[model samples]
Target: MKNNLTSQQMGKIKNLFADRVRFNKVERLVYSHDMGMMPEQVRALIQCTPDAIVQPISTQEVINIIKIAQEEKIPIVPRGAGSAGFGGSVPAKAGIVIDFVRMNKIIDIDKEDMTATVESGVVWQNLEGELSKRGLTLRTYPSSSDSTVGGWVAQGGNGYGGYEYGDFRQNIVSVDVVLPTGELKSFSGSEIDKVYSLCGITGLM
Candidate 1:
């Protein structure tokens, strides 16, 4: 596979993410696809191989990456646990794949408000376990418990228990996103629709 990123661009990314940046061909290939199994014809047409994979552990680091992507005019693909088998996390044009695994953290749990402030990279099963300890549980979650919160939100928030409670959108209080222009903004209520199920086109959550 061809290396789409120049050395200088790679260096800049390295400076931001240090050892978290992955430029190896094999690693890029692994990050290129998700749980989805595409046919060879489709894969060939889409060029699923990503140029690079980066793991950003914080919102500020995500902002920095967006800035570099904007300056270099490269496609930025945000990814979580890659549990969805719908090509949502696959790279179509071979650019940077922003893996959010490192950002997984349960920031807070507000039992009074029945809300949890967590990083997008957090897995549903892990969250559920924590909630169970407090005699609480998620109203809805994907069938694949390993799926990340960000992935579920990006895919329209539909999952198990949605019929009884509601979709993920209804459960969200707010979301912090880094826009394509490298601007960090928070969305809530009706404004959340702007980025929900957008597949990371508008921003990185």
Candidate 2:
């Protein structure tokens, strides 16, 4: 994480993002924690208040936000439902939180390939329901099916249906990512492992 941005830096973000960027104290506090279990001492002493929360509704918006953050050297925490039982989405330093709830559209569902292309913000249960309507279902999903697709993929592969279909990594055919430096790239096959490891640390999910 990086230190809080200067007002000038924040002004640039606000001008570019309009209402999608929030810096109010109430909203900042809301994005500071997750469903993770933390020690009382740690929780009481350190509230991970992000400098700002940015909600991007599309891939283009994500790319734009990443570009700004990179130019400003701001650390970004990409978040989904924040349900991982760990503080994976919590910003270690006060910086920017890219909350993906609005980017939750399922982009594609290919019955022929038995695959779905979803934005990272999509919820697993919603996808499961949609697939079932088409006489299909996910090979695996978190027991907390409400967890977002990006969040599950980023946190490493472990979930329900693992005994049969394996984990998320096996099911994920490829991923489209915005690199930390703000470049867009697609990774598939064995290459995806490297991308997965980078997770929220090095790039957008």
Candidate 3:
């Protein structure tokens, strides 16, 4: 039979994996704080410290990391740029911090179809820069230069120009997500055309 981790066992697990995370003092400090100042959000998450922070470059790697976390019953927090005014990026249980920053890649741009496929970590500016050369744009972009495409999409972010260009919710053609159930799912493509399918969030983004 397998043994459940006691408090001390969990602490040891945290300490053991601390060395695996690559953030230096400054990086750690930046991540230690977020844009939010609300009591619960600010006090509840001050970067309690993660067991191990790993950067996964592909969907397969993300799946593997989540599987390990679930097998151990450790709390997992998935983060991209770790920027959220609501402190949503903060780790509540402080186990594995899977940073997808390194996964930045624009996989495909089908000009004929007017579709672009990008990795979760790809930055919106990068896409804008590339697409602009072709006189195309995502029609919407987050204001922050450091804002990431993945983070933007995850939060359903919008910009001031949305008044004319449209909100972030309407600009998104599709979305891919990994639910807490340990499954990788995509809600775009033909599945989006269905009136009954709501895996991808519906109504106001």
Candidate 4:
């Protein structure tokens, strides 16, 4: 995978992200394995390390990274906290692992409308704390409260309180995504169905 990226491509990413892009073999190794308990046989056969890892601090940065990925024809795996326990964060084709940890800001908490706009990286526990201060609470949460909001959604809706208030899908108001073509778009209500059905092939949510 490293061999697929040209020096110019590497330079472009380095120039844009500075210290946030990592290529060192040791550091990159961490992205290979996920939270799943992989069987020894399967683990022995797969060398899953990604080519590089990029941590974007904002939506604009994510868009920029996607644009670069498009130009370079590289696979971009969107990751948040890497707690999904599934291999969703592990790059299948060995390209860029776009870690969203740095983008974990709670953008807006609209108590009036009973909704919140958060960066994809915002953790459930953090958001819960924020809402609790205002006497509000999350409708549902996964057993792992440290999981990112976006991660839960990508893992096919979320959490344990579905019996009481419905699942993640039922509560979602809208989603802001960065498309593969580097276009930024927002989908709400029924529009989000298309994105969900595509399984994120169209964009990063």
Candidate 5:
């Protein structure tokens, strides 16, 4: 793996994320793969190893990261739990890997509406436990209990409850996303179709 970020750019990221940034080769290598095993030929062709790994605790931090990546023309790969085996979380090129683990806060749960508002890093199992305490549970969830809500949503949302409740999209109410251009926007209803399963191409949810 090669270091693609300049010293000044690294400083800017350090300023934003403080001690949450990882630059060591070992650490970056850990982020290069997900649950799935890629073929040797494919692995040999791509630079899966990231230049750096950063954990952001808020949406604003994600926006700032996007700004920096845009300015430097670097690839930004968003990751959550790294439970998916489809290689969506891994970087195809060496760049920044934004790990959302630190953002795993359940913002709100509307009991009456049967809806939950959470950060992208919210793990499904944790959310299920919280909901169970309130005498509620998710209608559908991924087979991987450790999968993040945002990850599952981004990966096409078909899982344990697909037979009854359908895919996650049918249950989605809305989403707040930071677009590639650093614009924050909310989408719901039919508009959500634009952002679902886009793998962060359209925006970061």
Candidate 6:
């Protein structure tokens, strides 16, 4: 598949997300593999050396990279911190490994509505320190200081507080994702009734 990538095509993909994204030697060395826990065969696979590490600064950059990866039929693996105990971050195929750590930004907070817009890399521990002052929390939170909101959500995580605040899946207000085909989309949040009505219809029904 890589053989089909013309010089021009390669340049385009590189530039598509170049503003804050990058392709570098150091990136290859670090993100080429994931940090998987011991005693699992899965660890061998996630350690595949990616040809490139794509750091998307925004949702749009994510979409652009996915589009080109799709064109090249490159395996696009999404990743955050090296915290997937299941070794999901291990890329079996050498392709594009997207690191979302740089996208960490708190876009907005609506105290009246009790909602906050944040980038995927917002650490669970960091979120707690900020939200605690407002008498609120992520509802579902990973105990680890380095755990990211997106990584936890992708794994459908649950916390000890699940019985009250709900599990990781339930606590999420929404998610903006770039599909493998390069579609930028969001679920929940403003798509809902614009209020935190826990008892109301799930809006999914």
Best by TM-score: 5
lDDT by residue (1-205, candidate 6, tens digit) is 1223356755776677665444555666566555554454654545455666667787777777767876778776677686765545656666677778888898886788888788877787877778888788666666666877667666655676878987655666776655445655566855533212221112101
lDDT (Cα, 0-100) at 193 in candidate 5 = 89
Candidate 3 stretches greater than 4 Å from native = 1-30, 37-47, 189-205
Model 1: per-residue Cα lDDT over 1-205, one tens digit each: 8988999999999999899999998898798778888888898888688888999999999999989998999888999888878888999888899999988999999999999999999999999999999999998898889989988778876789999988888888999988888899999999999999888888888
The global C-alpha lDDT for each of the candidates, from Candidate 1 onward, is 0.89, 0.84, 0.61, 0.82, 0.90, 0.63
Taking the tens digit of each residue's C-alpha lDDT, what string does model 4 give over 1-205? 3445778988999998999999888777898867876666765675467888999998889999888888778888888778766677876777888888888899889989999889888999999999999999988888888988877667766468889888787888888888888889998889877566344566887
Can you list the residue pairs that collide in candidate 4? none
* TM accuracy, model 6: 0.76
lDDT of 1: 0.89
User: Candidate 3 has which clashing residue pairs, if any?
Assistant: none
Score residue 202 of candidate 3 by CA lDDT: 27
Sorted by lDDT (best first), the order is 5, 1, 2, 4, 6, 3
Best by lDDT: 5
Which pairs in model 2 have colliding backbones?
none
- lDDT per residue as tens, model 5, 1-205: 5698899999999999889999998999889899989888998998899998999998999999999999999998999888878898999988899898988999999999999999989999999999999999999998898988888767776888789999999989999999999999999999998888888678888
Return the TM-score for candidate 2, rounded to 2 decimals. 0.92
- The count of residue-pair clashes in candidate 5 stands at 0
Clashes within 3 Å, all models in order: 0, 0, 0, 0, 0, 1
